[model samples]
Target: MFPRTLLLLLSLILFKTTHAQLHLDYYRNSCPDVESIVRSAVQEKFQQTFVTAPATLRLFFHDCLVRGCDASVLLASRNNRAEKDNPENLSLAGDGFDTVIKAKAAVDNVQECRNKVSCADILVMATRDVIALTGGPSYAVELGRLDGRVSTKASVRHQIPHPDFKLEKLEAMFATHGLTLVDLIALSGAHTIGFSHCSRFSKRLYNFKSKTRIDPTLNPAYARELRGMCPEEVDSRIAISMDQTTPQTFDNVYYKNLERGRGLFTSDQTLFTHKRSRDIVRLFAFNSTAFEIAFVDAITKLGRIGVKTGNQGEIRGDCTIVN
Candidate 1:
């Protein structure tokens, strides 16, 4: 009793799902395909400029990994963007600009990476490039994405996982995006190249108890930075990121920190205790070959959180704030 139009639509849906298979490079159908076109176009621009695209992509991942790729962190504050360098948080020695601008620089060194890819795809790919430029793995990114329009400093306030998360809260946050603690730490490893803002986790710097402090053996230089940022009078509610060492790189320095008992955040430290994930952490820290493979697996998994490709959802045009 179905109308011919309805029957045809149902048949097409059956055909598409049954005929398609998911690959890391491409998702099935209109949403994903549209996203892919943009990603590719932007990547080409970067290539033309002789700039590698992966490092910037890493930064986008850093921004999004914690709270779902909201561009609030990148939009650059009114005063800071015009005169100050924004990537300050990305490195203890950054060129003094927003990391996304660093990504844009790479693309500009080539052309408009954004024009080639969706704002979403360029956002992540450019950040990844940021990570690679440092020393981390240049992870292969999946394309075909849309930008979000509703990110809030508030959302950044509430959902962005702290460098100091314990296992349970860490797991819960990652789970929101279909990730796990293993994913959380691995993603947090993106921090290896970036510097911390004392405001992010001032408590750990000022009042960490040895029992609560995961890495009692932090680098002396790192300790100095922490002390300077927090000052003795600063309150605990301050926020900071964990990858003060190499914020722009995607290499195993983060794992290296984990190995040295120097990981600044509880989130990074949690990897050593989990029964299931500890090994992956050790694996990444010691074996670059293994870490690269594991990082790809984890990042691939991370990108898929809550997204509906292949009938899950549509690609948006922007990535800064989710509408």
Candidate 2:
């Protein structure tokens, strides 16, 4: 039972964002092919750590947005050579300080590799990392991506899919990229780690029974872990996304949640209820290795979507600043 006082806090967060200082741009220029190979090597070395694609993506985007992806973020704020090469942003947001600076660092890494690789891969991967770092599924996507010369904040708002979407809406979005419903479900496997704002799932927490909020059907032990992270009455505004149960690592917990009827979002839980979606959910739950591989495949598939095959695009000499 929530005290009700907490529910009142919801009203405070309803104001629209004043507009973020950050926005993404797209380009048509292709980075030299070497960028893919080099970035992949960098990603592979850090695979075991909690960072990797997401962190690198962050560095890629931030750098491009600031100084054309020259790896400038790697440089130290104090202007020291030793600090410039620092890779700690992977572990710490903004190196555990200011995350915006880390966003800049992400841009830096991407630019440094931009001359060698495509910005598209860098941007797609960056979104994946944001999903991963927040505790969603981390799939392996393909590299050798090209750069975009004209990305913008408005594009992201219009282009990126939102949590509020229903099945028909999602299917259409994926279909735009030649994705199927199953792929949508599988792609959603990223929900394993990333979380949402309290507003995103407030209906589940406040409207549903507390027991429902703490579904007894879930992994009893894992449920405890969840409860600790999400107290019944705490700020639903900052509620962690369903993927947080084990955000650092990739695994079958997401599917398992489906089996237990604990899928956090309406979109997530829907997979288990529909006859068509159930099998994929079950398959994912029972096989961790298969899930990881499939997840990667799905991500790779998503990477190729919505691009101009012939001349729909143009490459910018710079990823962040543009020409």
Q: Which stretches of candidate 1 lie over 4 Å from their true place?
A: 1-59, 62-116, 209-249, 273-277, 308-323
**Residue 24, candidate 2: C-alpha displacement in angstroms:** 26
Residue 74 error, candidate 2, Å: 17
Q: What is the C-alpha lDDT of each candidate?
A: 0.50, 0.48
Model 2 Cα lDDT, one tens digit per residue, 104-218: 2444466544444334444454555555544445644444333434333222333345544556676776676555665677777766644455555545444546755643334
Steric overlap count per candidate: 77, 58
Q: What range of 10 consecutive residues in model 2 has the weakest lDDT sum?
A: 16-25
Candidate 2 displacement at residue 164 in angstroms: 4.3
